[model samples]
Target: MLDKTGDAEALGFDALADLLNINRVDREKARREGWRTLADLVAVHDLENSSERRGDEWGAGSPLYQACHVALIEFIRTAPAGALPDPFAPGEIFGPKLPPTLTVV
Candidate 1:
């Protein structure tokens, strides 16, 4: 998910959220307020400060950093090659736009 700020570095979480349509209303409001901007957000350097999830499964940014991370644990778990879409946030429904990062059998 990309950040909220229009900044290129922003998580664009709003965009990801938009593509998936998970937190539309809540997120849109944030976007409008500028609170979601990459600059507005403080980067977390540890899992504790980062997202609610942990591990290298996604963009394991420190607890906080200026970047996006995966929100679909199940998708990662069930994806044929970890390229599946997030169940709650649809979009890549068309399929991966890029190749899977690693090869799995």
Candidate 2:
């Protein structure tokens, strides 16, 4: 739930990663342990956001945040009623992919 006040832009990638609790270690652990549902992941995100809240740290207007929110909403909306998708599964959301690299030949 990032604020729309352009605050997220002020946050560096590390800061955003910390705020989201999706750092490498944590993400790996979570993936290994498995998240039961997208809702659960959203709850964790909201919980982290709340625990880390520092009085106007961010608001609900940040386009970045909105994009994330929308992504979650879309996931939830498209998910089957009783079948939650494995976001970490092959070709699934959040699946592992190498970062784009530029080669200077």
Q: Best-fitting candidate, measured by lDDT?
A: 2
Give the CA lDDT, 0 to 100, for residue 26 in model 2: 52
Please give the TM-score that candidate 1 achieves against the real structure: 0.22
> Model 2, 1-105: lDDT tens per residue?
334564444764445546665547554554566632323334444323333334455445333445666777888889887688677765667987656789999
Residue 54 in model 1: shift from native, Å?
12
Model 1: how far residue 6 lies from native, Å: 8.8
Q: lDDT by residue for model 1 over 1-105, one digit each (tens)?
A: 244444533536555334333344545554575654333333322222322444665455543342333334444666696465464443355544656579788
**What is every candidate's alpha-carbon RMSD to the true fold?**
15.3, 14.7
For each candidate in turn, the TM-score is 0.22, 0.26
The local lDDT score (0 to 100) that residue 45 gets in candidate 1 is 25
Please give the RMSD of candidate 2 to the true structure. 14.7
Per-model tally of clashing residue pairs: 17, 4
If candidate 1 were superposed on the true structure by all CA atoms, what would the RMSD be? 15.3
Candidate 2: global Cα-lDDT? 0.52
